[model samples]
Target: MNTLLEQLKNKRLVWQANQQNAIANTDSTGYQELDVALHGGFPQQGVIDIDSAVGIGEIRLLLPALRARQQQTQRQLVFIAAPMQINGEMFAQAGLSLEHILIIQPETPEHALWSAEQCLKSGCCHSVLLWHQQLEVAQAKRLQLAAEQGDALHLLFRHKRQLSMSLPVNLAMKLSPHAQGLSVQITKRKGGWPDNPFQVDMTKAWPTLTRVRHADNVIQLPQSKVS
Candidate 1:
């Protein structure tokens, strides 16, 4: 029995229950508050489901982490079916390499899924962002498997709605716009508990994007000087 146990351990097939509870490999999320909440940062490579409306700092929150992943792996970052044109200046400000980024717009949702799966399975991309509204369980699972196979991160962006069902993803969260940055609620996480809504302050990184509140309960934007 001792020899068998040693062999299993050598094969990396055995682990303590506590090890399962311990935090897995993660990269810094760039935001300190988010990193603490995530017990490190985002998962190194897996599916991250973000349920939020478009153009509300959702992509901003992820840019830093994506850039980190790309830098660490020296792989391309692919965006599929993005709702709007890719903003080069914004991503550049976040330190992502423009030359390493690729954009694909599929004609149909089916094609989008195929493109995303191929990109994730190609092993040349560090992260793939797919802006999709709907997905069945099997499709989500396929994407998850592809990400694992190629050692990449898959980010699924969708509309914020009450989740009647769950997808097989490593992390799932809902985001709402907040004055400071974003109000985030973790619906599910692989090796952690669901978190109550927490504020991810973006004021320091993006003062213009956040709302400023006065002592009298009035909110306003920081005015930009006219060019």
Candidate 2:
């Protein structure tokens, strides 16, 4: 029994909570405040859950980190089942190579997950973004394993309202729109504690996207006369 226990510990199949308090590797998130909250930054390679409403600066918030990963690895960044048409201009503005991006609109949700897994395990992708609304714990575990196998990042984007239970992911965060940028709350992180809600400033990087301090000025044009 003693020898069996030792083997398990050596393989990291078992560990005390206090013993696993820090992640082994991380990449800078580009946002100083967000990076500080996330210890150093996002994990280098693993599954991450981002729960946020679409078109709420969620993609913008991740652009910097994803861009960094793509450049560092010089690998493809694949998108599986994107909700809307991807704008290359936005990616170009963020300094991502347009040629390095591959967008796949899967025919079904199951296919979406399959595509994401393939990209993560291909060893040629730096990151795979999957806009999937439903995911089971088992499925998430499989993706996590695939990410580890290929040393890639798997980003799962879904609405917070759809989440029913905690997922077995490396990191999970909730995002909402804020005047300055995006308000982020760290809900779950492996080897780390949950952090309070904090604002990730986007004004400096994206002045036009951040909310402006101005009163509502309604310009009501005269109603056109109808025949």
Candidate 1 vs. true structure, TM-score: 0.84
| Alpha-carbon lDDT, every model | 0.87, 0.88
Put down candidate 2 lDDT per residue, 1-227, tens digits, no spaces.
Answer: 99999997885455456865767799989899988988899999999999988898888888989988878878999988988889999899889999999999989999998998989998999999999888888899899999999999999998954555877888999999899899999988877777899998898888998877565686768999999
Model 1 residue 76 distance off true place after TM-score fit, in angstroms? 0.8
Q: At residue 152, what lDDT does model 2 achieve? A: 95
lDDT of 1 by residue, 1-227 (tens): 99999996784345444444634788999999888888898887779999999888999999888877877767899999999889999888888889999999999999999999999999999999999988987898899999999999999998954488678788898999999999999888765667899999998889999887558866799999999
TM-scores, all models, native as reference: 0.84, 0.85
Question: How far in Å is the alpha carbon of 105 misplaced in model 1?
Answer: 0.2
Candidate 2 stretches greater than 4 Å from native: 1-20, 161-164, 213-227
